[model samples]
Target: MCLISFYLIFVFSMTLFIFGIYFILYDYSLFIEWEVVSMNSLSIVMTLLFDWMSFIFMSFVLMISSLVIYYSKEYMFHDYKINRFIMLVLMFVGSMMLLIISPNLISILLGWDGLGLISYCLVIYFQNVKSYNAGMLTVLSNRIGDVALLLSIAWMLNYGSWNYIFYLEFMKNYSEMMIVGVLILMASLTKSAQIPFSSWLPAAMAAPTPVSALVHSSTLVTAGVYLMIRFNLLLYNSWLSSLLLILSSLTMFMSGLGANYEFDLKKIIALSTLSQLGLMMSILSIGYSKLAFFHLLTHALFKALLFMCAGAIIHNMNNNQDIRLMGSLSLLMPLTSTCFNVANLALCGMPFLAGFYSKDLILESVLFSYVNFFTFLLFFLSTGLTVCYSFRLVFYSMTGEFNFSPLNLLNNESWIMLSSMLSLLYLSIIFGSILNWLIFSSPILILLPIYLKLFTLFVCFLGGLMGYMISNVSIYFYNKSLHYYNLSSFFGLMWFMPYISTYGVINNYLMMGQLSFKLFDQGWSEYFGGQNLYFLMKYNSQLNQVLQNNNLKIYLLSFVFIVVILFMFL
Candidate 1:
C-alpha cells in the first residue's frame, strides 16, 4: 500500500512539474486567493502567487522530492515504520510546496512552522538518542526562524496588513519596516544554517539518507534563500546588506574548511551543502537575488544527486561512512561512482556543468561588484576552498586503495534507486544550460581583464593541486602531518561548532535553571511558604491551647493588663 501511494504521489508531482514548465514557457503568472478571515481593520487571506520564480522553484522541488520518495522505497524497506516515513516525507513536500506558493506572511508562517515541526519528526524517525538530540537541535534552530518571522509579522502590523508583498516597495521609508527587514534577514540566516546556526545542518545528517537528500540538500535549507529572494527589494540599505554579506561569506569559508577535515560521508556532504547555502545567501545579500535564485535551483539538482550517490555507497558499505575507509570504489560501483564524480565536478564549477553556470557567474559578479576587501577575500578564498574539499573527497573515496573487506558490492539490486539517480544525472548534465537560457534573457556583461575573468578557474586549479598533493603527502607521511595536529583537529571538529552551538549556547540557560530551582523553589519558597508557615501556625495553636486551658481568668487578666498599659502611655 505504501509503495502504491508513493508511486501515485510521484505521478502527481510529475504532472504538476510539467504544468509548471508550461507556465514558464508561456511566461504566465497565476494568483488564486481565498478569504480565510475578515474583521474590521484586520483580514487574513490565503494567497498563492505563481510566477516564473515560484513555478521554476516548485517544479524543481517536486522533481527532486518525487525522486527522493521513489528512491526511499527500497532504501527504507526493511524499517517497520516505512509507511510513517513516507507520510512524513509527503508532509514535508507539502509544506515546501506551501512555502513556495505563499506570498502572504500569515500563510508563509503556516508553511514555515510546518517545515520546522515536520522536520523534527523526520529527524527523530530512527528513534535513537542521537536522533533525539539532533532533532532537538534542528527544531530549535529552525524555531529561531519562526520566532523571527513572528516578530516580523508583529512589526508588519504597523503597516496595516499581513500581506508583505504590498508593502515591500515603501519598506525603506519606515525605520520600523527596515528593522523588520533585518529581522527577516536574521530569520533567513538561521534557516539557511549560516554561521552560528551551522551546527544543526551537519547534525541533521542523523536523518536517513533520503531525508537528507531531500531536506538538507534542496528543500528545507534553501527555504531561507527563497524567502530572501522574495524580500530582495527591502535590502537596499548598505549596512544591512554588508552585514549579511560578511556573515554569509564567513559561513561559506567555515563550512568549506570543516569539510576538508571531515571524514563522515554524510557530514562532508552536509558541510558542502552548508557552503553552497552560504554562497546562495551571500549572493542574495549583495542585491543579485535572481542570480542567487539561479544558483539555488541548480545547486538543488547536483546536491540531491550527490546525497543519493552517497546513500548508494553507504548502502553498499554496510553503513560505514568514514571516507578513509573507502577507496577505489569507481572500480566496484561504477554507476554510483560516476554519479558522485559528476556531482563533485559540478560542485567544483567545472566548465559547462550545473555549478559552472551559476558558481562561475557568482564569482564574476563578485569580481565586478564594489565589495570591501574582507568580503572580496572571503569570497575567493571560499571558492577555492570549495574545490579543495571536493577534490579531497574524490581522492579519499574514489582514488585510493580499497580498504574494505572483500564483499560483492553490486549496483544492480535496486533498479528503482538507480533509475532515480539516472534521471537526476541527466538533469545534472543539462539543467544548468536550460536554466541559464530561461532565467537570463540577456547576458550579464563582465568588465574584467582576461586574467581576472579566469580568476576562478585559476583558483580552482590551485585548490585541486593543494587538495591532492597535501592529502597524498599526509597519507604517505603521517608523522610529518601530525605536527599540525592542532590545526587539523580544530578544522576536523568543525571549529567545535557542534559543541558550541549545542552545549555552549544551552549550558548557561541550564545552569541558571538549576540555580533557580535551588535558590527559590527549594530554599526560599519552600521555607517561607511551606515550612515557615507550618511552624508559625503550630506556635499559634500552642498559644491558643495554653489560653484555652487558663480559661476566662487568664483572658480577663490579659485584657486588664493591656488596658493599664494603654492608660499609662496616654
Candidate 2:
C-alpha cells in the first residue's frame, strides 16, 4: 500500500514540476474563483491560485511526502498502527496542499488550521507522555499564528473580500492595512518557529522521523514563508519589513547557535531547519521573496534528505538518537553516511551543492542591501554557525570509534529506505542549479569587492575549524559546561526559549489559575455559591422545622411578631 501511494504521488509530483516549469517559462498564472455565498453585496468565495511558485512548492511537498511514506514503510514496518500513521501523514500532506494553493484568507485559514491540527496528531502519534507534551507545545504555539490569521481574516472583511491577494497592492497606501500586515508577520513568525516560537520545533522531534522529514522540511514550517511570499507586496516600504528583518536575523543567529550546543541527532537537524527558516524569512523580509522561496525549495530538498538519513541511522541503532553514542557509521553504512554527509554539506552551503546557489545569492543580496551593521554581522555569523554545527554533527556521528553495543549489527540493508533516500540524494545535488536557471530570467548580477565576496568562504572555513576543535575535545578534558553550568544551560537550552515560551509565559498565568482554582472553584465561589446556598437552605429548613414542630408557644410567638411588625409599619 505504501509503495503504491509513493508511486502515484511521485508521478503527480513530476507532472506538477513539469507544469510549474512550463508556467514559469511563459510567466503564466491561473486563478479560479467560485462564489460560495453572497449576502447583500458581500460575496464569500473560494479561490485556487495556480502559478509557478505554488506548482513548484506543491511538487516539492508532494515529492518529499511520498518519499517519506515509502521510507516509513520500512522504518515503521514493525509498528502495530502503521496504517493509522499513513493516514495521518496523508492528512498532513492534504492540509499542506490546501495551504499551497489557497489565496483567500478563509481558505488559507482552513488549510492553516488543518496543518496545525494534523501536526499535533502526528507529533503525538507515539502515544507517550513526551510526545503528548511536545504535541501540546507544537499546537499551542501554532494556535497563536492561527489567531493572527483569523484576526487578519476578520480585518480583511473591511475590504469586502477575504481574497487577500487582491489587496496587496492597496495595502501600502492604507494605514489600517498595516495592522493586517503586522498580524500576518506575527502569524508567519510563529508558524516558522522564529524566536519565541522556536522551542516547539525541537520539542516536536518527539514525533517519528518520517513526520520530521516531511513536516520540518517542506510542509508545516514553510507554510509561513509561503504565505509571506504570497503577500510580499504588503511588506514593501512598510516598517513591518524592518521588524521582520531584525527578528528573523536574530532567529537565524539564535537557532544556529543553539544547533551547535545541541547533542540530540534529530534536534541538531531540527535546529538547522529553524535556522534555515530564519534565513528564508530574513530574505523575504528584505523584499526578496523570490530569493526566500528559492531557498525554501532548495532547503526542502536537502533538509528532507538529511532527516531521512538520520532516521535510517536511528532505525538501525535501536532508536538511540544521542550523537555521543554513535560513531564510525561511515564504515558500517557507507551509503547512508555518504548521503548524510552530502545533506549536511548542502546544509552548510558547501560550494555548488543545492544550498550554495540559494544561500550564496541570499548572502550576497544581504551584503548589497543597505542594512545596519547588526543585521550584517548576524547574517554572516549565522552562516558560520551553520557550518559549525554541521561539522560537529559529522565528527560525532561519522568519524569517531563505534560507541554503541559492539554486538549490535548496523547496516544499510533496507532497500526500501535506501531507495527513497537515493531519489532525494540526486535532487539535493542538482536541484539548486535547475531551480536557479528556471526561476530567474536573467542572471542576478552581484557586484562586490573581492574581500567582501570571499568573506563568506572565510567565515565558513573558520566555523568548520571551530566545529572540529569543539568536537575533538577529549571527554577527559575539563568540561567548561560543567564549570559554567548556567551559561551552557542557557545556550544549550536555546537561550531558555522553551522555558520562556512555555513556563515563562504561562508560569504566572498558571499560578493565577491555581489561585483562581483555590479562590473561586475551591474557595470563595464554593463557599458563596454552592456552600452558601446549601447553608442558607439548611438554616431555613431548620427554622421551618422548629416552627412546625407542633409547639404552640413557637407558633404563637411567630404570629405575634409578624402582627406587631405589620402594626408598626402601618
Best by lDDT: 2
For candidate 1, give the lDDT.
0.86
Q: Over the stretch 160-209, how does candidate 2's per-residue lDDT look in tens digits?
A: 88888888889888877788998998899999999878989999999999
The residue-level lDDT of candidate 2 at 304 comes to 95
Model 2 spans with C-alpha error above 4 angstroms: 37-43, 474-476, 526-570
Across 177-262, the per-residue lDDT of candidate 1 in tens digits comes to: 68888888888988899977889998899999999999976689999989999999887764788788888998999999888877
- Which 10 consecutive residues of model 2 have the lowest summed lDDT? 473-482
Per TM-score, the best of the predicted structures is 2
Question: lDDT of each model, Cα atoms only?
Answer: 0.86, 0.91
Clash pairs, candidate 1, are none
Once fitted onto the true fold, the runs of candidate 1 whose alpha carbons sit more than 4 angstroms away are: 1-28, 38-43, 407-413, 479-481, 526-570
Clashing pairs in 2: none
What is the lDDT, from 0 to 100, of the residue 504 in candidate 2? 80
Error of 1 at 166 (Å): 0.9
